[model samples]
Target: MDRFIWSNRGIEAGETKLFSQVGVRIYDGDQKTSYDDGNINL
Candidate 1:
Protein backbone atom coordinates (compact mmCIF):
# COMPACT_ATOMS: atom_id res chain seq x y z
CA MET A 1 0.00 0.00 0.00
CA ASP A 2 2.83 2.38 0.76
CA ARG A 3 4.48 1.46 -2.54
CA PHE A 4 1.40 2.40 -4.45
CA ILE A 5 1.35 5.79 -2.78
CA TRP A 6 4.89 6.45 -3.97
CA SER A 7 4.42 5.17 -7.52
CA ASN A 8 4.05 7.42 -10.55
CA ARG A 9 0.52 6.21 -11.17
CA GLY A 10 -0.45 7.53 -7.83
CA ILE A 11 -3.56 9.39 -6.75
CA GLU A 12 -5.31 11.38 -9.40
CA ALA A 13 -5.45 15.17 -9.53
CA GLY A 14 -7.79 16.82 -7.06
CA GLU A 15 -7.95 13.54 -5.23
CA THR A 16 -6.98 12.74 -1.70
CA LYS A 17 -5.21 9.91 0.07
CA LEU A 18 -5.87 9.01 3.64
CA PHE A 19 -4.03 6.75 6.04
CA SER A 20 -5.13 5.52 9.42
CA GLN A 21 -3.62 3.60 12.28
CA VAL A 22 -5.44 0.43 13.25
CA GLY A 23 -5.63 -1.28 16.57
CA VAL A 24 -5.94 -4.96 17.36
CA ARG A 25 -6.99 -6.71 20.50
CA ILE A 26 -7.08 -10.32 21.49
CA TYR A 27 -9.61 -11.44 24.02
CA ASP A 28 -9.78 -14.48 26.20
CA GLY A 29 -12.46 -17.13 25.86
CA ASP A 30 -14.57 -15.37 28.43
CA GLN A 31 -14.59 -12.25 26.26
CA LYS A 32 -14.24 -10.19 29.38
CA THR A 33 -10.47 -10.11 29.47
CA SER A 34 -8.08 -8.72 26.88
CA TYR A 35 -4.91 -10.78 26.45
CA ASP A 36 -3.10 -8.51 24.03
CA ASP A 37 -3.37 -5.16 22.41
CA GLY A 38 -1.40 -3.70 19.54
CA ASN A 39 -1.42 -1.11 16.82
CA ILE A 40 -0.77 -1.70 13.12
CA ASN A 41 -0.24 0.37 10.01
CA LEU A 42 -2.47 -0.58 7.13
Candidate 2:
Protein backbone atom coordinates (compact mmCIF):
# COMPACT_ATOMS: atom_id res chain seq x y z
CA MET A 1 0.00 0.00 0.00
CA ASP A 2 2.78 2.43 0.79
CA ARG A 3 4.47 1.78 -2.54
CA PHE A 4 1.22 2.31 -4.35
CA ILE A 5 0.74 5.67 -2.68
CA TRP A 6 4.22 6.78 -3.60
CA SER A 7 3.78 5.70 -7.20
CA ASN A 8 0.53 7.60 -7.43
CA ARG A 9 2.17 10.73 -6.13
CA GLY A 10 5.00 10.36 -8.59
CA ILE A 11 2.57 10.01 -11.46
CA GLU A 12 0.69 13.11 -10.38
CA ALA A 13 3.90 15.10 -10.11
CA GLY A 14 5.03 13.99 -13.53
CA GLU A 15 1.68 14.95 -15.04
CA THR A 16 1.83 18.37 -13.44
CA LYS A 17 5.30 18.92 -14.83
CA LEU A 18 4.22 17.84 -18.29
CA PHE A 19 1.21 20.14 -18.18
CA SER A 20 3.27 23.11 -17.13
CA GLN A 21 5.80 22.43 -19.86
CA VAL A 22 2.99 22.46 -22.41
CA GLY A 23 1.38 25.64 -20.99
CA VAL A 24 -1.72 23.94 -19.61
CA ARG A 25 -3.55 26.07 -17.05
CA ILE A 26 -5.28 24.29 -14.22
CA TYR A 27 -7.55 26.59 -12.26
CA ASP A 28 -9.58 26.10 -9.11
CA GLY A 29 -13.31 25.47 -9.12
CA ASP A 30 -14.19 29.10 -8.49
CA GLN A 31 -11.97 30.32 -11.34
CA LYS A 32 -13.94 29.40 -14.44
CA THR A 33 -12.46 31.88 -16.89
CA SER A 34 -9.14 32.14 -18.67
CA TYR A 35 -6.57 34.81 -17.93
CA ASP A 36 -5.56 37.57 -20.36
CA ASP A 37 -2.31 35.86 -21.34
CA GLY A 38 -4.26 33.29 -23.43
CA ASN A 39 -2.75 30.01 -22.28
CA ILE A 40 -4.83 26.85 -22.54
CA ASN A 41 -7.42 26.73 -19.72
CA LEU A 42 -8.73 23.58 -18.08
Candidate 3:
Protein backbone atom coordinates (compact mmCIF):
# COMPACT_ATOMS: atom_id res chain seq x y z
CA MET A 1 0.00 0.00 0.00
CA ASP A 2 1.36 3.37 -1.08
CA ARG A 3 -0.12 6.63 0.04
CA PHE A 4 0.87 10.30 0.16
CA ILE A 5 -1.03 12.83 2.18
CA TRP A 6 0.24 16.19 1.07
CA SER A 7 -1.01 19.46 -0.27
CA ASN A 8 -1.35 20.32 -3.96
CA ARG A 9 1.93 22.21 -3.84
CA GLY A 10 3.68 19.05 -2.81
CA ILE A 11 2.33 17.22 -5.83
CA GLU A 12 3.30 20.09 -8.06
CA ALA A 13 6.84 19.74 -6.76
CA GLY A 14 6.83 16.06 -7.73
CA GLU A 15 6.17 14.56 -4.32
CA THR A 16 4.07 11.69 -5.55
CA LYS A 17 5.60 8.30 -4.88
CA LEU A 18 4.83 4.70 -3.93
CA PHE A 19 6.01 2.64 -0.98
CA SER A 20 5.79 -1.08 -0.31
CA GLN A 21 6.30 -2.93 2.96
CA VAL A 22 4.61 -5.27 5.39
CA GLY A 23 4.57 -2.63 8.11
CA VAL A 24 5.82 0.92 7.97
CA ARG A 25 5.34 4.39 9.39
CA ILE A 26 4.81 7.75 7.68
CA TYR A 27 5.27 11.36 8.70
CA ASP A 28 4.54 14.57 6.77
CA GLY A 29 5.82 17.29 9.11
CA ASP A 30 2.91 16.64 11.40
CA GLN A 31 1.60 13.92 13.66
CA LYS A 32 3.34 10.59 13.33
CA THR A 33 1.31 7.83 11.69
CA SER A 34 1.90 4.14 11.19
CA TYR A 35 0.83 1.48 8.73
CA ASP A 36 -0.47 -1.53 10.57
CA ASP A 37 -1.80 -4.73 9.10
CA GLY A 38 -2.45 -7.62 11.44
CA ASN A 39 -3.04 -10.03 8.54
CA ILE A 40 0.45 -9.47 7.17
CA ASN A 41 3.03 -11.99 8.44
CA LEU A 42 6.10 -9.92 7.73
Choose the strongest candidate by TM-score: 3
> Each model's TM-score?
0.23, 0.21, 0.26
- Tens digits of per-residue lDDT for model 3 on 1-42? 245543323224544445434544555467664533412211
Error of 3 at 3 (Å): 7.7
Model 2, position 38, has a per-residue lDDT of 37
**In order, what lDDT does every prediction score?**
0.43, 0.34, 0.41
lDDT of 1 by residue, 1-42 (tens): 122122225457886767534465544455633324544233
Task: Count clashing residue pairs in model 2.
Answer: 0
Please give the lDDT score for candidate 1: 0.43
Instruction: Enumerate clash totals for all models, in the order shown.
Output: 0, 0, 0
How well does candidate 2 match the true structure in TM-score terms? Answer: 0.21
lDDT of 2: 0.34
RMSD to native for every prediction? 10.6, 10.4, 9.8
